[model samples]
Target: MFVKNGNCNFFSQKLTFNTLVVPSQPIIAPVGSDVTLPCQLDPVKDLRDMMVGWVRHDLTPGYIHIRNNHLDFLIDQNSLYLGRTSVSESRLQQGDMSLSLTRVRVSDGGKYSYFKCP
Candidate 1:
């Protein structure tokens, strides 16, 4: 189940997920401001092979790569999010794969999702 925060601006969820899990929480931020989209999980006992990623839901109907920890943004295939997206540096330890968009724009308002696997 997902729990909503006081301001109702963010949501959080937890569970014993299997494989690549998509916890619940679609962060929405106003344009022209900085925002962090958190993607976390209950600690998987053994994390020898875990992959996490943050993606933006394209209005035109598609998933655009925002940022991948090791490879960074897959810019060539994701031109729109090229320079406007970045992942949080604290992700590794904080279990937050949130993406920060500076100088947000109208185009930034949309569903944002994060995925993680073990």
Candidate 2:
């Protein structure tokens, strides 16, 4: 499947009938600028109430952010990401679990992962 994200076309796959698709290439952003990491469900599933999480698996408190209960949960978020990560509820309703990282820094360099509880 193909989904148009921003100015690029991203290829999507429906693995096991449900999957989250993201860009194949890395998103390059200048230091201190905000950037949106594109992510969306291939089958267009609504995730408003889903327990969606973004994390840096290598970190101690891996969690960067989480969304559920109709709000953002930050109690366990990593200190490096506090006040820097967010997800759009409106987009989540449409299955776009993209993470918005604000004020990028050198420490933020690395691969992040995503998961949904259920």
Candidate 3:
């Protein structure tokens, strides 16, 4: 699943057997504002130790944000998303993997994809 933001797009995940869920409609956010791309696992498994990643299909490398072992790692992240994206650390243990984007931009409008390691 994917949450295409009007400004800052959010990514949703995919899994085998269990599915990743998100809003049915587009997330509309005004430019320069904040947006949360809602996503979660259906069976609600802990993700605190997992690597959750958000990517934009149109870009090279495509990663806008990444959290691994409950920490954000900026290596190879796209410059357009630098210092603009985050995921809730507290919520990860409950399976919520939403990505939050700060200072939405017009160029940020697009579909996104979410991925997880294990």
- Superposed by TM-score, candidate 1 places the C-alpha of residue 55 at a distance from the truth, in angstroms, of 2.7
lDDT on C-alpha atoms for all candidate structures: 0.54, 0.90, 0.91
Per-residue lDDT for 67-106 in model 3, tens only?
A: 9997898888999999999999888888999999999999
Point out where model 1 deviates above 4 Å: 1-28, 44-49, 57-63, 66-69
Write candidate 2's Cα lDDT for 1-118 as tens digits.
9899899999998655787899999888988999998899988977888899899988889999999857999999999998999999999889899999999998888889998874
Best by lDDT: 3
- 10 residues in a row with least lDDT, candidate 2: 12-21
TM-score of each: 0.55, 0.83, 0.83
Residues 1-118 of candidate 1: C-alpha lDDT, one tens digit per residue: 5566786766555557443334366556677787665444445333223455655556443444433435554544345555666665555555555556667777766666666554
For candidate 1, give the lDDT of residue 37: 57
| Candidate number with the higher TM-score (1 or 2) | 2
Tell me the lDDT of candidate 1.
0.54
Worst 10 residues of 3 by lDDT: 10-19
Ranking by lDDT: 3, 2, 1
* 2 against 3, candidate with superior lDDT: 3
